[model samples]
Target: MPLVDKLLILAIGAQVFLAIAILVLMGRERVPRVMSGEIPVADIAVERSGYPLKARLLSNSFDNQFQLPVLFFVGALLLLQLGFVSWVDVLLAWLFVALRIAHAAIHVTSNDVPRRFAAYSAGLAVLTLFWLWLLIRILLVPSA
Candidate 1:
């Protein structure tokens, strides 16, 4: 494997870790409430009046794992699949991962909308750049 490929894998690994952290947080926050009859089981399927703020934050963070992060996974895999590897790709991948982590941290901790949005927006930009860079490379460089 090339160094760029390894870097992408590591960045993806960081994303997986963030997902696991959110899962664990959800478990810690939800389990106690559910067991204590504070949060009803049926309400777990969606955000509702019965849902507490901490649980909602964790749930939202977890849901976000399937959102923009999907683009990250696809972009990383596509880069590797088509052999478009470079330091720029690696840097942008890491930047996306970092911003995502920041978003999650703000979400689950303070639930700060502005800070979280900034992180998420920056992450989306990084993801877009990654995709655009890959597309340009694919169009310009003929595969040998």
Candidate 2:
């Protein structure tokens, strides 16, 4: 498989793992709160602490994975289908994945807005470039 394909798979895997982690975090906090009668139910409502800070952060991070990253997934698949794999595309795809991971880390750990924004912006830029490169390749290369 091409490096871009591998990276795309890994990025999808990261989203799945992050979702599981978010569920675990929610259970960890909600179970205890409910058992101790602090919260009447295992609900993530604004009234009941709103899923704790960490859980909320992880949930938000998980949500972000589904947004712009969808473009990366579609771009990679389009490149594969078009038989236009290149090192430049692979590198950009990997860069986007790394930046997204960094963004999630900053978001879930310190919840620092500026740091997370920097990472998110970098990832979005890479993804945009990847799509542009794909367009260029498709327009210039003749079909097989």
Candidate 3:
């Protein structure tokens, strides 16, 4: 596997970890509330709590994993399928993964909108550039 492909796999792993973290946090927050009769079982899916702030943050972060990260996954796989490996590609892939981790940290901790948006924007820019590079390679470079 190419380095870029490995980075994409790590990125996907990060998302999976985030999802599991969300589930754990949700149960921690909800189970106590339910036992206290503060909320009904049917309302569990509604994503609210007497202290809903953390749960909402986790939910939002989990949802973000399926967004631009999808493009990152697809772009990486396309490059691998076409055998377009390059150091630049690997660098950008790592950048996207780092920025995504920072984004999640900001989101789940401080919940600062501006900081979170900046991190997400930086990651998106890296991913977009990766796609553009892949397109140029596919369209212009002669395959060996």
Candidate 4:
């Protein structure tokens, strides 16, 4: 496989693994509480108000995996499909993933808004550049 393809695989794998880890962490917190009738099924079913802070933190972090990274996923596939892969693109992609992991770590641990926002903003900026760079590259290239 090409290096870009490998990067995409690792990126996807990382997101998947993170999601699974969050699920396990949530299960650790949720199962006992639910089984003990501490949190009603209705509350969890309707909304997360019933979930405690720890579960909420993990849940929010899990939710983030689906957010901005969606663009990364799409952009990655586009890059592969269009054969527009470059070292700069790969570096930005890795940076985005790393920042997102940092954001999730802070969110689930300290729930620190300032630090989380810094990581999130940086990742968002990188994602924006990723897309903008891809778009510029596509527009600059003449169709065969």
Q: How many pairs of residues collide in model 1?
A: 0
Measured on C-alpha atoms, candidate 3 has an lDDT of 0.78
lDDT of 4 by residue, 87-112 (tens): 88888888888898899899999988
Error of 3 at 31 (Å): 4.6
lDDT of 1 by residue, 1-144 (tens): 998899899999999999999999888988898899877788775654567888788888999999999999998999889878899999999999999999999998998799899999999999999999998998998658
The residue ranges of model 2 lying beyond 4 angstroms of the native Cα positions read 1-37, 42-49
| Candidate 3 per-residue C-alpha lDDT over 25-123 given as tens digits, one digit per residue, 9 for 90 to 100 | 767866787788777766765545444677677767778878887887788778777778677887887788889889988988998899999999999
- Residue-level lDDT for 139 in candidate 4: 99
Q: What is the lDDT of residue 94 in candidate 2?
A: 75
Every candidate's lDDT: 0.90, 0.76, 0.78, 0.88
Highest-scoring model, lDDT:
1
Clashes of 4: 0
Query: After best superposition, candidate 1 residue 30: deviation in angstroms?
Result: 0.6
Question: What RMSD, rounded to one decimal, does every model reach?
Answer: 1.6, 3.0, 2.7, 1.3
Residue 17's lDDT in candidate 3: 73
The better candidate by TM-score, 1 or 4, is 4
lDDT of model 1, residue 89: 96
As for candidate 1, its clashing pairs are: none
